[model samples]
Target: MENQKLILVIGGTGAQGSSVVKALSESGRYSVRILIRDSSSIHATELAALPNVTLFQGSQDNQKDLHAAFTGVYGAYVNLNGFSIG
Candidate 1:
């Protein structure tokens, strides 16, 4: 991860978010940190297996989680899940 930009992705286990996260990680241009509800989830686990991809378990609606996600991130993809937050 040295000299790589770290991007924090919300909803990274979802359809669009997962696609974007995979693309970014595979590009070798950036490292990605995914904020998800469960690290044990199949989707999350798959994403975490990719190089430059990591999992940070937390809720999107929680300020503490948001703060944690925002830390050390060069950018963010905030695709909030309607099912989880609505």
Candidate 2:
């Protein structure tokens, strides 16, 4: 799968992130790595069950975790926690 594009998705267990993961995974064009805080959580477990979707245990608050998640990824989709009207 080296030829496939690697996309790192932060907050992939949340509602917004889960949608993005589903969409991208269905596209069959990219491999997705989801950054989740708890691998044993229900959402994380569900996402991990999907094909082409791997879970990376980490947190946005840690620079080291973020750095590790960003490695070798062709692209990234970061969804921070908050509500905003735009």
Candidate 3:
């Protein structure tokens, strides 16, 4: 990733965002950054192993977490769970 643009992915552990994250990683274009509640989870660890993928452990509701996740991102893909929010 010489001039890679970092894409921040929210809800990346869920059904939808996981695939997006993988595709982005496989594309070899942008660097993928995912925010997850459990950084040590199997899925999180798996994503971290992918090319250009970085895992950041944090919740969306926290401003500090959001700030850190959003830092220097080229763009974002957010798909928060409505049920979980309720």
Candidate 4:
């Protein structure tokens, strides 16, 4: 991986996102930034404990937030949290 490349991880506090964070962080390869709606949320706080993990306020519907989160991002992992129809 490139040095200091930012990877913006959407829904990083949820189940799948959390696993991604762990894998990325443990590898010590890329920088991970988590986009969360609430900074004070439990999952947000948990993710904040990991090294090289930055948490910022963001939402999918808000284009501005998405843009801000993706600024200087070398990669992005978008994890939609809604349930799917069977």
| lDDT top scorer | 3
lDDT of 1 by residue, 45-70 (tens): 89999999999989888999889889
Q: Write the per-residue lDDT of candidate 3 for residues 15-63, one digit (tens) a residue.
A: 9999999999998889999999999999999889999999998999999
lDDT of every model, 2 decimals: 0.91, 0.87, 0.94, 0.85
Model 4, span 1-86: residue lDDT tens: 45867899987877899999888887788889888888898888888888888888878778999889999999999888676311
Off by more than 4 A, model 2:
83-86
lDDT of 4 at 49: 89
Instruction: State residue 17's C-alpha deviation in candidate 2, in Å.
Output: 0.9
Error of 1 at 13 (Å): 0.7
Q: RMSD, model 2, all Cα superposed?
A: 3.1
In model 1, the runs with Cα more than 4 Å from the true position are none
Worst 10 residues of 2 by lDDT: 77-86
Q: Pairs clashing in candidate 4?
A: none
Per-model TM-score, in order, reads 0.95, 0.90, 0.95, 0.88
User: For this target, which candidate reaches the highest TM-score against the unseen true structure?
Assistant: 3
Please give the distance, in angstroms, between residue 16's alpha carbon in candidate 2 and its true position after superposition.
Answer: 1.3
Model 2 gets an lDDT of 0.87
lDDT of 2 by residue, 1-86 (tens): 56679999987877898999999888888899998888999898888888789999988878999999999999999887765312
Q: Model 4, clash count?
A: 0
TM-score of 4: 0.88
